[model samples]
Target chain A: MSIPRWAWVPFGVALALLAVPILGLLVRAPWTRLPELLTSERALDALGLSLASCVVSTLLVLIIGTPTALVLARSTGRWTGWVRTLVTVPMVLPPVVAGLALLTTLGRRGLLGQHLSVVGIEIGFTTAAVVVAQTFVALPFLVVSLEGAIRTAGGDYERAAAHLGASPTRTFLTVTMPVLAPAVASGTALAFARALGEFGATLTFAGSLQGVTRTLPLEIYLLRETDTDLALALAVVLLAVAAVIVGLSQRLRGAHG
Target chain B: MTQRLALLVAGAALILPLAACSPAPDGPTVFAASSLSGVLPGIEPEASYSFDGSSGLVDQIAGGAPADVFASADQRTMERAVSEGLIDGEPRMFATNHLVLIVAKDNPAGVTGFDASLDGVKLVVCATEVPCGAATQRLAEANGLTLMPVSEETKVADVLGKVVSGEADAGLVYATDAAGSDAVEAIDVPGAEDDPNTYWVAVVKGAAHAEAARAYVDSLVGEWGDDLQHFGFGPPL
Candidate 1:
């Protein structure tokens, strides 16, 4: 099929806009110093912390978000619209605002936090806070993607299974889940990527502390202030990791399709 | 043809408003450190100001940002800018600041002094890259104390925010910042007086509004002394 001339204008514009920055990163990256910079204790620490927290948050998103997505998919009411809107609010809200919202509700002096503090338990500035910030921001990605998948898959198969003496739970577990596996895998990857890049919310809510809350983005921001070259190297690392995950997920989807 | 024209008109409608909202090219764009945020507003309310960490400002200036004046919270950053040929001339010292430990108004942690022995108290401080962070390091080294901060924030305002929100028990911030906010109380560090963090102001090369930038810098260096003093900043030495 021949592409229209006008379409190429916008397509080329979008391609150049996206590709130029990545090209710039490749051209300006301190290739010689990258080995030393990536191996530095601070860089490694941030990488380890980011991977661990993002993995935990992705699992949390899958567990909690799957049910929320399923509910939104099955329901058809005014309340469902409001519920879906509420679930996607964090995805649209500024990350810093999300952090402040979390802080006000979970900080030591926060409304719910004050009660928790009374029990001699603190959540702020802990590894748990990092997971909370990540999950809060990433849950929407999983839920939105899975809800779309569930809606597209429809309920015909599940209904047919139910009429044939299959229980609702069994039909969901055996039939609905397998059909949504590719969507789940893709959504998990996107959520994990989003969580890994989380900065403002993590910094504001969990605080930037090494081995606890200082993730890769926070480390890159700090390094940008002190060492630009090292910051570039770390950014390249993040770019590589995100690209690999996205690429793998696309391949998985293709295979499943 | 009509559809393409409509699309073109819609695009122009979007771009025109954004272009109008941008800072006027004729106005003096001042890139000042976040620590000077309080005083700069009082000094030159008309000039467009970009307030952030000095290093970030330096990076922006180096990247050819159209800034007229650069006010840094520390000499080291200004010196770096000069060495990089980002600024036009020598930077002049405009003001000085001392580090102080700040706590929430309620004093939830009961932080009395700047010593390291306050066990179990969660403290926050500026990251070492910024001026306030460097001053914090100097203060710690001089007093032979090891600070156990829960967070090393990018800027002084962030440290103040954490303290004001009671997320942190205490934070080491500029005397001006501590005095500027009623939500937090400042505790004077003993040796902080000896190592004052000086503010430096310089004009950027190829500034569009050079005269206006110079006047703004002069106001901060001369006429704004009383206002700076009121805001708890030390007189330029």
Candidate 2:
């Protein structure tokens, strides 16, 4: 495809806008102290928590969100638009507001939480709350991406499989899922990345306790107050992890195709 | 399609510069500590405000935020600002506050006070990085008390919030903060009176609204002293 000359100007500006801040970070990052910073107990704890919680949240999102996307993609109901809008609210909401919403719904004194606590079930300020907060914000990305893919893939193959005497579940597992594998992989990657970077909601809902609730981003925020050098080093580590996730996902998509 | 693309490009061209070049606001932008969130607006409603942990505000000012005035919750933070040459002159002590133990209304946790009974309770406090947190440590040490908090929040407001929201049994926060919120009941911390946190205010070094900024600081320590008191702040030390 031949590129328009005028379009190049805006494209270059967009590239610079993204690249410059990263360059600033790289330039300011304490390269000499990175290894020491990364290996510190606090850094290791935050990194471990970020990875563990993101993995759990991504799995939870897949289990819950896949059905949601499928239902939205296949539904012909009048309320489908509204349902999808509600599902996507977290994506557009300021993460802080999303945290507040979670608190109001599930905190100890929250509407649902009040009832749950009566049975000795508590979610607030726990590791479980961190997972919940992460899953809440990450679910929309998977649902939105997979829904579009399901719509684009259509139901022709699934119908043929059903006509051939394949059960609905079997058709879904074989015909429907195989065709949507690329979308699922990309969506999972996006959800995982979003979970990894989640901060405000997690802090607001789960609270920041080292090794229990504070993820890498929250650690970076706290460290920035007391230790800027360590904070910058941890940010560079997070940037690298995000880049690797993206690169590996792109490769996985190409391989599937 | 071409017309739409042209319109988009023109729109970007028009808005980009305006976004990049933020003109000075009508009034001074007072960067204040989060402990003053409730009272600063009432004290000088004419000026704009940005409230956060004093350390965070200092970082922002150092990183080139266009703050006209800086109000800190403790002497140490204001000293750091002055030491970094972020201030125009000596910061004035405007108000003083001490630590207090706050609990959910009616003392749901049945915490008697800042004593041994607080053990095993869900206590929250400010992190040692911020002003309120530093005062919390000092007060605890002076009283020879050891506290094991469930969470160490970045802002005094967050500490107060955890108590207000019923997520925590107790939180250590400023007297002014506990006094301002009707959702919680305040209990005095022993030795808090001996180590009160002093609030300081000063104009920023290179503020765009330098004159307005100075006037605002002057009024806060002068005529607005009583207003601070009305909002639960103690008189300047």
Candidate 3:
């Protein structure tokens, strides 16, 4: 394929900007210290906890946000816009504010917070809260992306299949869903990448603990104090993992495209 | 006329960048804790405060954030800067606060003492990284008790919130903070002093407005700095 001559300037510039940061991550990644860091039990524990929380957070967001996106995609009027705007509130609010708001509403002494103690159900300061916080911040990304895809897709395919006697659920499964799969997959990948890197809200809403609530990003932050090299090493690892998932998602999108 | 529309567009173009970059002149840009608001001068004659998390303030200092002066909730962050050579002079202990366990005022937990914060009791603590959280953890360790909290909050205020909101049965926070809450009752948590003492101060290194910054620091350390001690923050420097 022949490329346009004028496209090279901006395209090359954008590529350079993107590649420079990755190159820096490579140059300063502390490759030689990998053996020493990889051996530590605490490092393993922190990584495991981070993976567990990000997965649960992504799953919870998907379960709740998927239906919410469907409604937002189909609704009309000022009310729909307001509800859609409200759904995106977490994405706009500072993560710390979201954490504080969560605390005020769900903390031990909150309006509903007091009732939790009576049932012996505690949601703050644990692994579960880490998931909750990550989900709270990350769900909107998936919701917005999927909702946009669905709105652009329109409902005609499902409606046509239904007119031919296929059930609403069946038409959705067979016709409308296949086209939206790319958006769903990409949304999941974006949410996963975001959840993997979430720090402020997690730290604010879910306290960092070595084996308890300390996610990889939290560990990287704490490590910045006593161990700069080790912290950089963790950053490289986090970058690498997020990159691979993003790469896979792009490949999936391309195959579908 | 198209000329008026052009002038309006020109006006908006000129104002937009300046509006984006400038801080409002109304406030002091004071960075302190919510708990300290009541005890401090509350308002300077000229400037208003922009309260923020203590760790955030220290990070801002390290990152060359613009500020007149900084007042942290704990000494560790101030010391972190001192060790890193980011700040100018020594940071003194401006106030001291004991640890307290906060519960909903309704007392629905039927709780009374440190025992309520033990295992099986839902508790909220600052993540071990922050000063208050470390204090809570150290107190727990000194008492030979292990508390697996329901969640760990990044800021002390979040821990206070977990208790204030009733999400956790009890939360460990500074006594000064607990005292400020009407909906939450404070139970004296023993052995928090065994942990390192939290210090607050006014250290403005690389300040944009050095004169105003120095004045703020000066008022915080002198004999006139009695309001800090009066609020039970500890003996003022």
Q: Candidate 3 residues B1-237, lDDT tens each?
A: 465445444544553465358564533355665567776654354655656676666666676556666777777777766776666566655566778878877767676778733557667776675667677777887877778776665567767765665556678887777767787988777776545366566656666666776666666666334565556565543
Per-candidate alpha-carbon RMSD to the true structure: 3.8, 3.6, 7.0
State which candidate, 1 or 2, has the greater lDDT: 2
Best by TM-score: 1
Which residue runs does candidate 3 get wrong by more than 4 Å? A1-31, A57-140, A150-165, A198-208, A221-231, B1-59, B66-76, B115-119, B141-148, B191-214, B224-226
- The sequence of per-residue lDDT tens digits that candidate 1 reaches over residues B1-237 is 676555544544443454345556555899998877777777778898899888888988898788999999888889999999988877889888898888888887877788754457989998887667888998888888888888888768889989999988999988899888999988889899789988899889898899988887777777645888888889888
DockQ comparisons of all candidates to the true complex? 0.39, 0.36, 0.18
Top of the candidates by lDDT: 2
Tens digits of per-residue lDDT, candidate 2, B1-237, equal 676466546645653575467666778999999878888888778899999888889988998888999999888888889999999988999888888999998887899998888898899998787667788888778777898888888777788888999988999988888888999999998888778888899999999999999999998889645677777778886
TM-scores, each model vs. reference:
0.93, 0.92, 0.74
Candidate 3 global CA lDDT score: 0.72
Please give me the DockQ of candidate 3 compared with the native complex. Answer: 0.18
Which of the numbered candidates is closest to the native, going by highest DockQ? 1
Fraction of true contacts reproduced, model 2?
0.34
For candidate 3, give the lDDT of residue B181.
Answer: 79
Provide the interface RMSD of candidate 3 in angstroms, 1 decimal place. Answer: 10.9
- Point out the higher-scoring one by lDDT: 2 or 3: 2
